[model samples]
Target chain A: MTLLAKNITLSYHQYEIINNLDLEINPNEITAIIGPNGCGKSTLLRGLTGLLMPAEGEVTLDGKPLQQWSKKTLAKQIAILPQNPSAPEGLTVKQLVEHGRFAHQGLFSKPTLEDAEVVDWAMQQTSVIDYQARLFNTLSGGERQRAWIALALAQKAKILFLDEPTTFLDIGHQLEVMELLKELNQLHNIGIVMVLHDINQAGNYANRLIAMKQGSIVADGKALEIITSELMKTLFNANTKIINYQHNGHQKSYCIPVGI
Target chain B: MKTRTILRGPKTNKRFYISVFALAITLVLSLFFSQIIGAAKVNITDFYDFFMAPNESAAQKIIGNLRMPRAIIGMFVGAHFAIAGLLLQAVLRNPLADPTIFGVSSGASLAVIASIFLISAIMPTTTFLTSADIPIFYVPFIAFFGALLATFLVFWLSWEDGNVNPKRMALGGVILGSIMTSAVMAIIVGFGQAKAELAIIWMAGSLYGRSYNNLIPLLPWSFICVIATLAIIKPLSVLRFDDDIAQSMGLNVKLWRMVAILISVGFAASAVSVVGPVGFVGLIIPHLAKLLIGGQMFKLIIVSALLGALLIVLGDLIGRSILVPLEVPIGAITSLIGVPIFLIILQKSGWKLK
Candidate 1:
């Protein structure tokens, strides 16, 4: 259930997006991809999801080339939740989540008992069961984001990719989503690779932090070891103050960027 | 029963019931009134008797041959346009997208006009010495080819680098549709006497000379298109989300999008081939159906199809009877009637495009 991208080079209209990038994701860890704006964080995530083909290099999942795997087969193992996904009007939370079961369903198959069970489980895990009947458009931004996360969970994927999942979310909802990710990683052993805008959140939540600068990995290690002032200054071109604290007996690190 | 239980949701349930009620009322009223109100009015009781057991009366012959076929043709054509419109709206994710917006109707119309009016005139002595003995079945075939060609052109123009951008598709369709319609208009104006009657009939989208032969050829293709649509309802719903999300969920987005376009083209073309380009039914009916029933593609498809059928049948009936001996075009009637209702619904719903 590991994903490996080897020397991946990606470009759009002759402009290089990801240049000779290589990264490896372990089976059971929360890995966060962080970089300054236009530094190819989202581009790398897209490359991993097969949405954008690499100009050169190979992406392998479980030691098999991603291109060789059928779309459905790949989807079964990996689910992606894009930032600010547009939902159809009048779609309920349950209905939206049920769509995640598409890969598992046959051409003529109706939603089976197992499918329902999975959807229900996903909704419960995301704490969206209470709003299962609510129209997606009617929900608040935070709730809506959770509902989309639930949809990804419903896929029952062993690996998940989230593109800036908490960008527009409030601090409370951000923690909620992060905590859910941590629980999912710990309990289900699902590998999570996400693009995060907030360096503090990435430091707090992710087990492994991969910082990209100019389409290449500048730092990739355990969050605490790589989130130092020098690495932050180099990656973001800004001075940063590191604060260490204990939260509910768990050690945590926080970064405050100067001249933000 | 089990499926109904699983499908239960307050909004979905309410919409489903309302759609069922509206469709039932529309179907009955349209069918009953369509048979009764023609050039020569017949009693409702007489119309029923004619259908059950026909007597050798002119009223019976007119009811059986003219009005009934007209209504049936209207329903089919209406359903086709409406469903096509609905699919287009969903696929494009644009509220304003419809069969006409995409130029499928115009493309088909151009093909038909060329085959029916221009081709026959240019090669007058090639096949049959006289136009009277020419096979009537040939008209729809030519129209079908026209529709297919138009759709192919639209697809070619809009598709770029494996992406079918909605805006590009609509723009391409509009340009192509305009050119084709101009050609149709030019042909009609250039050959006034020889093609006037046929052109008028096609424009009005009448059911005057339709036989079982017309319905037979179109039925199978239409059914196939509709069934294909039904099969893809789940994928369409998934597509309603972001394309990246849908792709990650294992959908072959490009292939499915192409299939959807083909279905829309097939149904729209088939309808045009049978009847002329009946406007507004496809544009307005799907929106109305969405209002009555929420945006579940499965339910939306059926309700839109039924509502479309209802609108056209009623519109055709009104056209046939309102002016008595001089029948108005069903296309004109649909636009006149449907546009206002659509606007009213749009106003009520605050024109929210979701």
Candidate 2:
């Protein structure tokens, strides 16, 4: 359950994007990574999830290097959903979710009863159970995203990583996804880490916010402590006013970008 | 009630069983039809007489030696090419991908053509005596290696950074196919008319004179490749998604991709070596299967294998019988029939690759 990135450097095509970045992921909290475009938010997510090998340090899961862990064994602990994943033609939501149990099933063995139960649970958790038999390509943008999340959930992993889960979603759907993630984190106690484009959504939903600039972590702390007009100016070079409110005995914070 | 209804057992959909039943019936009918309806005056009684009676008549010999082996070869060749095409399209994530797209058919053609020229040049006395003059048994073997070599070249050329892009592989296959086609043309023209007629017939693709010699060599290959295809079915289905997504699911995407490609190469090369590159069954039958049974990998493979065999057996039957003394190549027959049916499927299903 301990996933740590120790001085890792990730690069694409010989150019360094994340250099000597060190961070440890908590196994029971929602962590949002907020950064501008090309600031390496997605690259860091890929690096941590074993999708990309770091050029310089190592990513350790339970104090063992990622390479030492077999792909299936590692997959049993960590699941990732890339932005805008495309399914094969004619694949239904249930079929797509069934793929999440791949690491749990043998090469030639049929899916076990547990695997089917997990698939059904994931679909219901994401509220995509109604669309289980529907073609994935025919779903709307929000429903498609939910189906993808359900697929990841069917992996039954302790930690889930998503790259921009709310991109291209309208306001209502964005809130819908964030609320679902919040419920998943609180109720299931699954560790959630996501690279979010909307700073307000990050501040509103994430338990911890890690702000980045040019592939480096600039600030990492609670949303209330790190999300300020000064931090917004540093992260995005925008003039903004921090707005704080109280709702249901919880403190909420968001910043309005007024000028560049 | 909803949970009870949703938690059904692990059986496949009803449509899949129906498709399997329909394909099985057609496959048997096609096999029987291919046996009886050739250019020779053969009938259903000859089928029983050949099996039941020990004294071989002229018609019995024809059925036992010629028609039986040819039909078997036709069925297997069709099945091999269809499954190969399905794997290629799945791995490439392209609807247009087929065995030829990997430089398999054209490369085998070029090798067979070049080797014939070399043999003819080495012995000028037997230069224009047709393929029968040469040791034709080795043609299938030579064509197989040629397919592997061409596929290797295309795969090597398509490699960039750490991964092979499906788009690049498709484009590389196109370029290599054209190069081999031109090379084949140049060799045929430059080498004069020495064995050119035989080479042209092989290139046009026919099951003529194919017998136990061809079927025996392909049997082991079909057994191994088909089993390998089944073994990798799960990864093949996962591979239809983006590479990164597949990898995140704990698949060694690159390794599995290589295995799938190699299995497909085994199928296409063996079948082409036997039948000399029958084209449309590999290209169109998988699409037909996908349209009929949906794109579930296992069901698609099953339906494609049966439909492919059915198409080729029937096509070969019509090819020989329709022309009487003259023979239309099985490849020509398949394309002529496959295109119209493919068009009809397209219009009816409104199938889209995306």
Candidate 3:
């Protein structure tokens, strides 16, 4: 397994955050963790990245303990960008993207040709190359988020984690970020684990969906199989209707929740 | 497609280039002119003679022993304060944050004040080391401990529910710093003879009469602290993003924050020990540098250091030259010059509080 968690339990003081959670993430797939607010979705991603140690469990990446891996090694294998990343005033996109190469570049060594190439390619892939010289804070929310994604891509990690990448974006920008993630997964076969609030977006784009309620997974399977009306009601405490639609000549399933 | 491609190209290149060029020019001008502006007017020939061949004449003593050391120390201390300010501003994620704003300077000053007043009273016969006569090695050591105690106290008080909120942290620092500053003032007022001279000199922030001996002690410690900051530059840049985002990027947010704070405190402490709380260099230089060069850690460090060095050297020169025979304190000079420039920048930028 590229990443696996066994019997993971986490807590903050007396409140249990994640209780006896177990999961495995395969290579080259888009896995979406869907849940209502405060359902420990972010906490799970934190545990996977070794940011938060589970109270009573272990997370292993490539058969080695996650803690055993050095920060640089983990950084090279996995890149994550969370929601609403803040930058200091006047931070240019190029400079921000250059930070992703930190894990690969040594302290004394300057940026090599290959590092520059990767950074350039990452910017190109995310369509942020044109804004490379612009201050990050000056960009629109969507544009800024794209720059952050470009930074993560510069790491050239095989796996990427995103926490609510589309949170504050308008619908169009939301689609833009989603399309970028889809392209990264399809073109490079990168493993993607993202916490998504919008159930329809998750169902449409994710290969696998894991539904969580009150810090434990209630359903886990292929998107169509796991995102059932019963599961949606249990996970979100709302009645949901699943509908079929044709989008650009492709069949898509959309979920509409009612009576919160 | 063409429009999008063009939009993605380098946007702020012109501004960055101009700022860098300006910073370089200022550094050279400041360093060169500061040497000539001291109390005794030594011409260009005397400056060259002091540099090219030392001990040639007694006039060289005025340039070599006094002005030279003072200028170099000013430059180094200024660089340290500016870099520390940059780090603190980034860590707090607030533009207004500076080294003194976070109580680090006041912390060190309080410790020094206590050492001056209380330590002397406890041991009446023991000799108190003066900055000029004392061996240079011990100065930074005393300053480092004083700084460490103050920052530790700030850190301890600011911790609530296991997370450090930037706003609360700043408030805590301000409250503690004010308390310390008042205490130091009380001690200075209460002690009549032996403590008064040291207290007044430290409060005014003068670079006068500092020797190479005083500079040596601060050099190595400052170098280590600055180098440590360089190591964390990448992480710090990532941290500028929101906390969750930084963590997702595989940065250990809590650990990195602690590391940044520790290094910043060390730099501020060392600078304060030598330069005596030169203000606004820390508060304003980082913002000015950020405005000039975009906030890439690599570029920010270089530009902030250079700009800071330039400011201090200029402040020292103005302090010495403005009144001729009687010197103005370097701190007063810096505040007088820096505040106006800073306000202008703020006005032009149309900075609005978030």
What does candidate 2's lDDT look like per residue over A44-134, in tens digits? 9999999999999999999999988988888889999998888888777888889988888878999888998999899999999876777
TM-score of model 1 (CA atoms): 0.93
User: What lDDT is reached at residue B271 by model 2?
Assistant: 85
Candidate 1, A141-214: lDDT as tens digits? 88988898898998888988999999888899889889999998998888899999999899888989999999
- Give me the TM-scores for chain A across all models, comma-separated: 0.97, 0.99, 0.96
DockQ-best of 1 and 3: 1
Question: CAPRI verdict on model 3?
Answer: acceptable
Tell me the tens digit of each residue's lDDT in model 1 across B80-177. Answer: 88888887777777777777667888877777766655556755533221234235456555666776677678878987656876777788888998
Error of 2 at A65 (Å): 1.7
* Candidate 1 Cα outliers beyond 4 Å, as residue runs: B1-11, B14-18, B122-141, B208-211, B344-354
DockQ of each: 0.61, 0.59, 0.37
lDDT of 3 by residue, A60-108 (tens): 9998988898777888888887666676567668877887887787656
Number of the top-ranking candidate, with DockQ as the measure: 1
Residue A210 of model 2, lDDT score: 95
- What lDDT score is found at residue A14 in candidate 2? 98
**Candidate 2 lDDT tens digits, B216-285:** 7788889999999999989999888888788778788888888998888889888887788788777788
Regions of candidate 2 where Cα sits further than 4 Å from its true position: B1-12, B119-141, B192-194, B340-354
TM-score of chain A, predicted model 2, versus the true chain A, to 2 decimals: 0.99
For candidate 3, lDDT tens digit of each residue in B296-319?
677788889888888888888888
